[model samples]
Target: MNVEFINPFLVSLVNVISTMATMDLKPGKPQLKNHDIAKGDVSGLIGMVGPKTKGSLSITFEAPLILEIMHKMLGEKPSSINEEITDLVGEITNMVTGGAKNLLSDKGYDFDMATPVVVSGKNHTISHKSKGKKILMPFSHEHGMAFIEICFEDI
Candidate 1:
């Protein structure tokens, strides 16, 4: 992935998360994760297709952060990862993707995003079809931490 392709997602993630959940998040420097399977308790994945590239992106949250976010969004404590929480994550993924898509299109990377797919379990893994580099960006909030992985391939 070109390093310039990362800025949209980074800006979108921080802006949307702060707006929707009313929480502040800071991103750490992105690093190459030399693995296919992404590790986390809850993961939301979305596929992307564009004229010049095709790939997928995922936002994975640890258990504690997932719960914290859900509670903030739903205005109640979530005991576990239930359907509502899963849907919330999916919507969040969609929101981030949409914002990134808008920004990227301005930079000439027009893409359509697929509906989000959410998976949750104890240390589950998210696998993508594309064999692209996984640029992992970790985000931290007062509640906990999560990771956003961008896998992009230029055609």
Candidate 2:
């Protein structure tokens, strides 16, 4: 995976979470992911396709972290995963992907993003469409942890 591909997502994640949820996230080291099982309780996945490349990006959040984010964003935090929480996950995925898309576009990479899909469970699976290498970036906030996974390849 190209190292250049990872920066935009990191920048976007920090920007989106800071602006919308008013929370500061400390990013941990990014590593190559070897499994399909999600690291968090909830995940939002979206695909990106372009003339030159195709890929997927997923954001997964632990229950406590997501609940805190929901509280900050909507002023009401649910006790557990629900429709509204899932919707917020989708929205956050969309925004972060959109922001990264724009940054990549500036570098001459054009892409069309599919609607984000949200999934929640104790140990859910995340199936990224692309066969590219999956890079996992973990982030920690005051409440708990979240993860961002990216997989991209030339098609």
Candidate 3:
């Protein structure tokens, strides 16, 4: 992925989501995910395929952040990971991907996005073609910790 093509979406998506959710988020240095940078399970993923590239957008969070986000978004305390919260994470990932898709499309890159897939665990890495650039944008609310990773390859 060209950094120029990818960075705008990363910044824009974080900006849109933070504004809508009323949270302040900053873009931490993005790097390719390797054994060193990743922590817990990856929560949600959405794949993108364009004329010149293919990649995926993923969202990950610590358990506490997930719980707190669920509570705040749903107006109830969540004691455990349920379908609802997992679904929300997936939807959020999809929304972010959509934002990227729209931006890329406007730049004359036509692409289609796949349905988001959500996963749970403590370890797994999102890998893409080593041809372009890999980006991992970390975000945190004053009260919640979350990150979104976007990986793309230019064909």
- TM-score winner: 2
Per-prediction tally of clashes: 0, 0, 1
Candidate 1 lDDT, tens digit per residue, 1-155?
Answer: 66667878888888877887787789988888876545778889999988878899999988888788777776887788888888888988999889889887887788889889998888987665577787888898877778899887778
In TM-score terms, candidate 3 sits at: 0.81
Model 2 per-residue lDDT tens digits across residues 1-79: 6667788898899899999889999998888888775568999999888998888899999999999998998899899
lDDT of 3 by residue, 89-108 (tens): 78777777777677767778
Candidate 2 lDDT (Cα, whole model)?
Answer: 0.88
User: Candidate 1 vs. truth: CA RMSD?
Assistant: 1.6
What is the lDDT ranking, best to worst? 2, 1, 3
TM-score-better candidate, 1 vs 3: 1
TM-score of each: 0.91, 0.93, 0.81
Give candidate 3's whole-model lDDT: 0.68
Q: Rank the candidates by TM-score, best first.
A: 2, 1, 3
lDDT of 1 at 140: 88
RMSD of each: 1.6, 1.5, 2.5
